[model samples]
Target: MLQAIRDTHRYSPGELRTALRFLAPLGLLIGIFVLLPVLGTLAGSLYLDTTFLERRFAWFDNYCGLLTDHTFLQSAWFTLTFAAVSVPLELALGLALALLMNSQVRPLGLLRACVLIPWAIPGAISARTWELIYNYNYGLANALLGGLGIVGEPVNWLGTGAGAFAALVLTDVWRTTPFVAIILLTGLQAIPVELYQQAQVDQAGALGRLRRITLPLLRPIIIVALLFRTIDAVRVFDIIYILTRGGPGGSTTSLSLYAYRNFLGGDFGYGSAASALLFVVALGLSLVYIKMARKLKIKMR
Candidate 1:
């Protein structure tokens, strides 16, 4: 009994130490970064006014007002439209780029590296660069159009609602497509060469092989890539904010930017409500993605 007791005591401390070592850093991260901020935000959102220099509870008034706010509605719609348009286009373009890169093209390694450069750059920096290019008077975009005789005057690219929206889409696409390409490239590279070899032996054309073999095997990866891009696009703020500030008459405002402005503009509770709503949307997308992933897994099996 003493020997068994000693053995138990020996293992108990070791196990406890091991568990503590694993959990300590995680606990610190959660407490300091995640938990604290979330609690602060929630607490702030419940207050009557953050700017009051005094504390008072507001209950659900902020949330109730947010539901009726026209600006929030417009921002939500604009953000949704941006995601709906951009995510599908990015997926298609990225997959196409991945396939092209995967082909027996010359200097494929260099090509892949070149393609990733845009995605590797900081998004705000990319936005700023595009903003310069988009400048009406002295921009390269106008110069190119002029060179091509496409227009008689320098297009005020960011001066109109449609123009600003288009610019945001273009900049985002340019910056993020490379990431999509990289993700799809991983999927493409995972495809067995033997499958293609056998398909060729069976006299399958490129399109037939891709349709029958490549896509079936790539569905999961494609879904994953789409999910990642869609999530990012849904919460997109920096590019649009920097380029348009939801301007040209709030034409390009997104939910994230809207929430940020509310919070910064001293409507903390309302902003928090908007943020919570956005969280719901993001969470819904995540659930859908997970369901799709599971369905793909079942189909694969």
Candidate 2:
């Protein structure tokens, strides 16, 4: 009882007031910027607010249509598939890059900054650049492939379902891998060097040290990176819009894009429904990711 009392922290009334004051601005901002918009969208989803038509209450009809809409289903599947594939690849590549950065590489500052360039580039600009690279005639990708004898002809990257999928995956991985690497690198730097030194003294080889020391320590950060990347992938929109515009029979249409299309077509009620559903999915996945991470952390500890 004595130890528990010492371990507990109790805030005084002054501290409670100060803390509340400090948090008030953040609470207000969230209310205005996040909660209000979300609530508005949810309320709007229940009504038919189309142009040149009387506003009518929808009452979940839009959601029922989404359940049976072939386009919506296809887009949802594609979005899930994109996230499933891209998130894992990003994790793997990010892990490799983080390991490299963690090593004693020269010019570390410059190299770290260079690694961030891809991520810093605007999505629309990068997408446009990639569009050119995927061009059928004289594009850089095909030129290299042909020069290296990898293929006889230029591949139509955004012209087919499979090709477009692969293109988007590669683009997303390239663009976002650096973000994961940076996060993982922070975790790597936090690990005590003494741990590695001790492992080495115990006759642990490089692989043994990495497996026993590095990976276990880095697991939490990896899961966090996974959560972020998966969420970004699930809501991927601007890149798809700029790169392929959900081309090749809408094979790459993400749920976001699907909803955007409805909004563009003036189906406000339906679009709001789609947006609400996507928000729910992202929220659910984030909760699951956090819970799983917590469970793993507890198990490991």
Candidate 3:
């Protein structure tokens, strides 16, 4: 690889230089916005004080403290549970929607565009909208339930512990399911038409085709979408903050919200530690998914 790269560069030095020139700006931007912040966070996590006025190195103390911190543990647990539940739901609904969109239907272009509306809307806006919908008095949720005679009184959707968690999950699902659907739809479109035709000639029904061909082929794309959604769910903050503010006894507080609270409270070191831990958790999850995807790909091959 090294000799090949050297030969290519020797034969086309100008092309190599031009490519480097074009990439320089992107590399600089990533360094400034991504790499530097990550390094700074890692460094800050090792110290007891982030401010230059009172710098004190306390290696791993903040991480150790997190193990015993009830708020941190609770937030971590809730965040994990949230991702675990919401990711699968999003994948299932998204796949179903993708199947629907992939079908031969009237107004296909308009339907595809309409499906993306929820995903195109900002999460903060969606959260606010859902908050209003879930409001106890004069809220759509309560009104609809009452009219259907499901509940005699207005249920405080965001006030109670279970209600707040469910509300957040529902909000997240509505906002992100479209994104998952779009990804799966792309994957679905990439599937070869010839394969389906052959399956039809072989007397394979829809379920058999899906089981043997479609799913196996779509596995990689599904894993990619799942990884994206899982990471997003783990780092979720804006929607939860907007809707519940981790209210009702901190039942819905996510790791990101917990980190933000610590940061705002001037515990920079602790906040950075929490942020670093969140990064690690997200990275760990991504790595696991990548490993599983690679193994699956190998088996498929």
Candidate 4:
């Protein structure tokens, strides 16, 4: 029996060689594609001015400088505030849309297609379109507001700090809410219709049904939607960049925007450190979301 087991455990040289040959390419590809870039970013963050190669090892100076910088701190605060406001709004709007679409409605297909249109457009293009819409001279927003006697002046939406921040949030919410709605719609569709019918038979009203049935079933999807929105909002750059360039007074300058500015200013070490910090923030958020997901799983079971 021992001899038979030993024979089974032993691999022939030819088989071992074939297995190594197959795995070697995969390992090499991973090293080149994945491992190298992460290592390079870390190395760059640690590097300082070097006459020999334009940069040299500077240890934690970049990170320390970033932590002490007022602009970086303000940018971080702005990013958190943006994400905090936008994420909940997206989830709420998305959930409402999903619920509305789930009901028997007129022209449902057409409505869904229209709802997804904003999400289909390129973010940059949408930002530019919104910029025009918010223009001080001929923008539709000021025209509508003026028509309603909401304001005497054609408000310069992109020409002020608060206006620019509001514009960024509105544009981002419009562009990304469809994504959350789609995710929630999938969750809603998976829910058994019988559950709703049962609730009706129990004489549960809309609020009760939503609280007792819909929300419980939709927890996972809600968590996932929040995760996606939070990460995206924290890293927001393109829309704000295109719309206001984090402008008017740096009101909308986020962490990612700061990183880009640093990189453009040729502060590679600082930029890399900011990027690494952003990565850490994103990773921490993902872990928290995953933990919440696990808790939901336990509750469900």
Q: What TM-score would each prediction reach against the true structure? A: 0.87, 0.93, 0.91, 0.87
Candidate 3 C-alpha lDDT tens digits along 117-232: 99999888988889889888879989999999999988888888888888888889998999999999988998889999999999999999999988888898899999999999
Q: How close is candidate 2 to the true structure, as a TM-score?
A: 0.93
As for lDDT, the candidate ahead, 1 or 2, is 2
List clashing residue pairs in candidate 2: none
- Per-prediction count of colliding residue pairs? 0, 0, 0, 0
Best-to-worst order by lDDT is: 3, 2, 4, 1
The local lDDT score (0 to 100) that residue 253 gets in candidate 2 is: 95
Query: Residue-wise lDDT of candidate 2 within 6-32, one digit each (tens)?
Result: 424789999999999999999999999
Question: Runs in model 2 with CA error above 4 Å?
Answer: 1-10
For residue 221, model 1's alpha carbon misses the true position, in angstroms, by 1.2
Candidates arranged by TM-score, highest first = 2, 3, 1, 4
Model 1 vs. true fold: TM: 0.87
| lDDT score, candidate 4, position 68 | 96
Candidates in order have lDDT scores of 0.84, 0.89, 0.90, 0.87
Can you give the lDDT of residue 56 in candidate 1?
71
After superposition on all C-alphas, the RMSD of every candidate to the true structure, in Å, is 7.3, 3.2, 4.2, 7.3
